[model samples]
Target: MSAWLFDLGNSRLKAAPLGEDGLPGDVLAFAHDGMALAAGWDSVLPPRIDAAHVASVAAPALRVALLDALAARAGRISLASTQPAWAGLRIAYAEPAKLGVDRFLTLLAARRRGGASLLVGVGTALTIDLVDAGGRHHGGRIAPSPTMMREALHARAAQLPAVGGGYRVFAADTGDALASGCLGAALALVGQSREAAVDACGGPVALLLHGGGAEALLPHLADAVHAPALVLEGLACWARPDGARR
Candidate 1:
């Protein structure tokens, strides 16, 4: 039976085909503005699959909307959630459910790579989670992502444009400065988190970067592994009994 995976995030809905190997096929993304769907949301979606597995960090209403859309296409649907431990990986959260499912899934994928890993997801928020060589969650941090930082700045000051410019070492223009500052801040956070992970885990840490905004941070992160479909990749792990050991 064929299965498709859906990752409904705060700003994007990504879907991919789940192969027998438990790896996701080409991923397709759709922009979701909180409650509203952006243009062409339906045009990009794949036709009905045999079953669907959904991992959502969106609001309850958004999940409802997504489920409704999938109901017509999927014979069965399963939702992913945060658990204390799964497939050798243990969550550090005192209240596991409070932790985002996206983060939980990311850890699963990170663990699949084996050994210590630092997952950096840049979406509506910049999230960093550390997993030791033994698959023990060492906690994480969430800050405004680059895009959010720009939006926040623009919101506070009407003069600043939320969307404009590129990253530069020393920005000559306002837009470049905003871009440089936000991305630089993300890069610095990653560096600091890497150091902390080394100190906490007392060993080397693999840098795993993912999410829609990950590209902007890529050029700056030299030792980073880019897995844009990481959340869905983790969803594949959650779908299987053995967690698809590669």
Candidate 2:
């Protein structure tokens, strides 16, 4: 089947073909704002696809627009939702619906790695989730990502630029200081989460990072596995025939 996986996030739309081995092929990402939606997909997606499996954490309007676009090109479309328990990975949420599907799908991919993991997603928001070797979730934390922090600070104080500067332990300039402070906050949170996960899981936990901003934090973290296409990988799992039972 010529199936494709779509991960619609807060700022961008990521798509990839699902290979026979149940992994995502080369990923293609598009910004959902400013550009004409139809034009963006038209230039990138194939002429037609047999199936399109989507996991969206975008705004409702954007989600509806994506579905509309897919309707014209795909024979079948499946939307992934958070499940309390599926394929051995159990959620920690009392109300499963409240959990973002991106985080849920990230956990699905993390569990497949077969070990205790601390999954951190750095996008518009920084999300940290921990899953044990047994596929049991121990909950997570969410906060404004460094990019968002910069944007927020810029909004309040126009002099602080929203998008430049290198991360430093102690920056002499305002831009670098902003970068350092915001990124440091996220790094600290991840560090704390890893420590907590180690205590809860009774051993050292694997650290997995994903999302658009993950690359920026990679240098500071040792032995962290960067899986930029994790959500799409999870979507690939959901697209499988035995996905629900696996």
> Which 10-residue window in model 1 sums to the lowest lDDT?
37-46
lDDT score of residue 203 within candidate 2 = 94
List per-prediction Cα lDDT, in the order shown: 0.89, 0.90
Per-residue lDDT tens digits for candidate 2, residues 40-132, read: 564678889999999998778888888989999999999999989877899999999999999999999988778999999999899999999
Q: Tell me the tens digit of each residue's lDDT in model 1 across 133-224.
A: 89899999999999999999999998999989998989999999999998899999999999999999987899999988898888888788
Candidate 1: segments with Cα more than 4 A from true spot: 38-48, 242-246
Worst 10 residues of 2 by lDDT: 34-43
* Candidate achieving the largest TM-score: 2
> How many angstroms is residue 201 displaced in model 2 relative to the true structure, after the best TM-score fit?
0.6
- Cα lDDT for residue 26, model 1? 90
Pairing residues by index, what is the TM-score of model 2?
Answer: 0.95
